[model samples]
Target: MYLQTTIIAIIMVATFALASWKLKSPEISMVITAIVGALVGGFGFPSRLLVEGMFTYFDVGMIFLTASIFINIYSETGAMNALVRWIVKQFYDRKWLMLVLLGILMIIPGALTGAGSVSIFVVGGLVASVMSYMGFSKRRVAAFIYLFAMLAAVSPPINLWAMLMAAQANMPYVGFNVVLLVPIVIIALFTIVYTGTSKTPERKSKEHILSELPLPPEGMNWFKIITPFAVLLVLILLSKFAAFSIPVLGLPLTFVICAFASAMMDRKRWDVRKWFDVMVKTMDQVFPLLATVISVGALVNIMTATGVRGLLAITFITLPMVFIYITALLFAPFAQGALSYGSAIILGTPIIFLFNSVGLNVTVTAAALSLLFPLGDCLPPSRIVGRLTVETVGYEGSYMSFLKAIAIPWLFMGAIGLLMLIFPNQLDFLVVY
Candidate 1:
């Protein structure tokens, strides 16, 4: 019986690894993994526990997806094109003494809308085309673009990551706040400075550069293009945390307002039909993620109800105290946060709980892991940011070269990790688990 339980657990973990390696739908694999685990764990495993966990995680995932889809629809309309186009012109034409500024600005699009496939298709395509013309390497370009993009994916207001963080820690929204943002910001700055210094000077002369850069909108106001995106984000934030509450519709109203704004962006401002269509499209994109999260709950429920997870937890805690504790903290994130942003956010919950049980401050441990394990969905292989940058004018290469470009950012993110571990100040703003 014990051997059967062990095999079930092994299959569950193997499912995650193989799913990612083969690039399958992780949730589907997890579902299959759970069924297998349930069979091996026997009839004693409580079905009610699995049902409760599934509903809880699934509902959480649903709320986030709903919020994001509402925002995505609002931002993707070409109405916002004017603002994006204007920013592009201004950024390219500006007098710049440093390469770091360019990198930092690159991530803005991903940060704003959310880094899902469709959004990336729109945002990354534009950034890549511009960087190609500007003599910036695509490798260098992808690095800057994805860092901010991933940051946007994980950050607050629309932070699906925060929900997972909260769920894992068994804490509330107030616990996360902007405190976690500090370490991330610190890492980003450090990566920029380090990466910029090593590269050869970027002197393409104003005459050469300006000619290549596109012009800002002729008559279009910047606000018109950006106002919808800005207003929607602001409205979402206000509804989420601000003390001033709207008595009428409440929190869901944030999505409603943003969706309305997005709908308004259409020059023709088509009928309700188009808006519904967008909502449908959003659902299509979100389903796989939904499935994966639900399956994870089932798997966890089975493991825990059978007493296997608790046993494994104790076994892990039993080794030499320091090494055991630190090792457990370290590997948990990798297991949970593997390449997909949605999955990482979903799985990171369990890892957070395990860390908290060990007496390490949940915030410090989470902060440390967040710093160490980046590249959730769209980052480099080694989790190193520097490997992704480019020294050459126009060159792209194998996976290895891509990793090199992102190398600096990885190092920078790591430094932040070290600080999170050692800094006494960590206790100050930390969300107690």
Candidate 2:
């Protein structure tokens, strides 16, 4: 059974490799892999199983999709622009504080949505513009955007890698807030400050900076901008503190509510038609992500049904501890590059289980592993976030140069992940569940 399942897993992986090579679509490649794996496992045309599997990440998909919608509406309403301008106006002279605030801004969307790509889309361009004015090279600007966006996705509340693994392991996705937040915050601050500083740090005049930024729409203010997020924060806090009294608005619904409030608060009111158009655009923007989530779910189910997951799990658990650590540090990102979030289920789940078996804290371990996953978003096969960052920042330098620019911070983030894995027990107290 082991040999057969191992071969089946190998074939499925080969199928994915071939399909991804030819198709250039991660979701399609994964779906094809699932179909092939099921057939090879002698469950030909297992329609019911395939369909059921697609729903595995349904909740996760909705969270990203809805959160993205809120982000889009917030951007559309000029709140995002006003907020960035406000930050620069207030703190551009403070250099380090401004960079930290900007880094935090870049982190917010991805943290809310659980995909770094969201951060790149919503704020990468704006942040890159600000960084450019600070006299950073184009490559460094792209690297900063890519790095914080990566950190944002790995941040708390919506870390897809950790959430995916937790769901698969039947672990409550609680107690991870502080465990994930601390290291990510540190890494983001360090990366931004490190990149922001140079031999001669150029501080653009405040007038020049404000002039470069897109003007906030007429009637746009911080109050308008702050209200929607305030609503979101209050709702989330209420749900946690007043669980029985409040209807449990899941993340998706909560985001939708925020999106609606954002639209309503718009100085330029969105007509129903405009809202519909925005929703449709949001769906179009998020379709690839949603598709990837569904395909990952299907692929995981197929692997489990064919016992491929078990085979891989057993193999990983039997490896030397040092080798396991090496794999987490090295392999996790590449797997993520190839398979996107599916890598978390395929690789992360097994590693988490293996660590848990040895008494490591699952929350810290998962958070550590998640840090590595985003690094892959900047690597090969499908360098989704990487490519987007380059395009967003208009980095005309060689891709290698961009990679080189981020190399230090990338390794720094990975080292932190490795340390977390090594001392998860020590860090376990950070878990606030």
Candidate 3:
């Protein structure tokens, strides 16, 4: 039974990979794979299992939905454009400084919201024009923006993947901050420097660059422009240290408050119909991801029900500890079909348990795994961020260009994962108690 079930699970996984690679629609692939797995395993369609799986991530789906709405309202206020214009004006003559700041700015929305897709549309879209003005190619700008956005999505305070991993391991989400900070800083610096050095043939033309930036609206209120993000950051930080819990999820709550504030501040310009339209479009864009989350839940349920996860764990137990460590690092990047959160919960939970059984620190192992999970965001088939980057930056070329541009950062992050694996003891300082 064990062997047969294991084979069935492997086939199911292979089907998912093939579908994701060939069909390029992880949501469809996962749903289809779940149904097929159920039949093959005599689980008989698994209606309850499918419903349970989808509902498991219902809160996360809410976060994405509300967060997208909030960002849409915020963007409609013209604040994002105003902020970009202000930054360009402040560092108009200092091209390198402007680029560095712009990269950092690109990271903020994702870091705050824990959604790279939101950040890509909110910030990545605006920075494309700025980077172009500074003489960087569209491909390079796209790669840079996408890399930072991914980093922010997984960064501390609100990183969806880290939050899910910590919950799965029964650890506090706050604990990940210490371990994640190092890699985040390292990657951010690398991005800043790389963007600073990238120059186009039009490098020397400050006048041309200035001419290209969109002018902030006449009578633009900087206070209104900064308020929404300010409210969001304060609420998130307070939730972490304050004694009280906010109603609903902290993330969605923060977004709601900010969205309301933004709408009030821009009352004159705000149109309910327009805002609703944008919200609908955002939902349309994010539906695939939301569906993939549900599919992941179903797939994980099927694996657990068939005892495949247990068999896989036992198989790993027989391997040398060192080999197991290396395997986890390598497998981390390809674990997620299309979404990082799904991959973290499904594949990451088991890997953490595997490492814990070997007497390794679960916290350190989980941190390392979490760091490596986002690399999958750049890999082929469902390369979520890669496709988003190309589209947002208006890159005319293939998705491969975005991947190639981000290769160095990807390898750098992978090396960190390997280090955490090989030197868990030395890196034990990163573990939260």
The lDDT for every candidate, in the order shown, is 0.52, 0.88, 0.73
Worst 10 residues of 1 by lDDT: 380-389
Model 2 lDDT per residue over 171-203, tens place: 988998998888987888779777866542665
Pairs with backbone N, CA or C atoms under 3 Å apart (clashes), candidate 2: 175-433
lDDT of 3 by residue, 1-433 (tens): 8779878878887887787778777777877778878888888989998888778767777777777778777777777778887787688678767877787777776765677776787878778777776678876787688778778787765677766766766766666777777877887787777767766775536566566656655556878887887888788667766737654346777778888998877788768687778778778867866876677777767777777766765676566777756676567777753544677876666667767776777666766776788878777567777778888888887666667877877777777777776676678787563
What TM-score would each prediction reach against the true structure?
0.75, 0.97, 0.90
Weakest ten-residue segment in model 2 by summed lDDT:
196-205
User: Which residue runs does candidate 3 get wrong by more than 4 Å?
Assistant: 204-207, 244-249, 337-340, 431-433
Per-residue lDDT of model 1, residues 277-303, tens digit only: 777776775665566567667766666
| Superposition error at 132 for model 3 (Å) | 1.7
Better of 1 and 3 by lDDT: 3
The candidate, 1 or 2, that scores higher on lDDT is 2
Best-first order by lDDT = 2, 3, 1
lDDT of 1: 0.52
